[model samples]
Target: FADLKRDRHDDETINTVFRSVHSIKGGAGAFGHERLQHFSHHYETLLDLIRNGTLPLSEPLIDLIVAAFDTLADHVI
Candidate 1:
């Protein structure tokens, strides 16, 4: 809900995702999961930029994030 379907409260959803990814990164690092940690670091960075308005949220960007998240899921699974 960071773009097309966004509402006034959508920021909460965005922030929640950022936090979740951040936690995953931290856990991965602690466990020595370098690949997971590295991917998550970049994913978290992208989310950070989007939430802070450093990067504009667009459909293409959303698709990119979704694909990256899928990769992250693969790393964990």
Candidate 2:
């Protein structure tokens, strides 16, 4: 989140976020957390788009992504 706050367009940061979310999705699936898995799948898709240059890193989108991260954290707890 700090990386994103500093520079949402940074490729390294975007890739890191994508990988982390993908790992979370895998763990969620292994643990039978279907809702989390589903959410992370969609979140991963969004990150993928950003990483692939298909989506521009807009401020509103960054806000949404951060909120999604918060949601994922909520689920984990």
What's the C-alpha lDDT at position 31 in model 2?
95
lDDT of 2 by residue, 1-77 (tens): 77677673568888888898999999999999999999999999999999898998987888899999899988887
Candidate 1 Cα lDDT to native: 0.81
Which tens-of-lDDT digit does each residue in 1-77 have in candidate 1?
44434433466667887998999999999999998899899999999998998998777877787687778778777
Model 2: how far residue 62 lies from native, Å:
0.5
Lowest summed-lDDT stretch of 10 residues in model 2? 1-10
TM-score for all predictions?
Answer: 0.83, 0.90
The whole-model lDDT of each prediction reads 0.81, 0.89
Task: At residue 69, give the lDDT of candidate 2.
Answer: 88
Q: Pick the candidate with the highest lDDT.
A: 2
10 residues in a row with least lDDT, candidate 1: 1-10
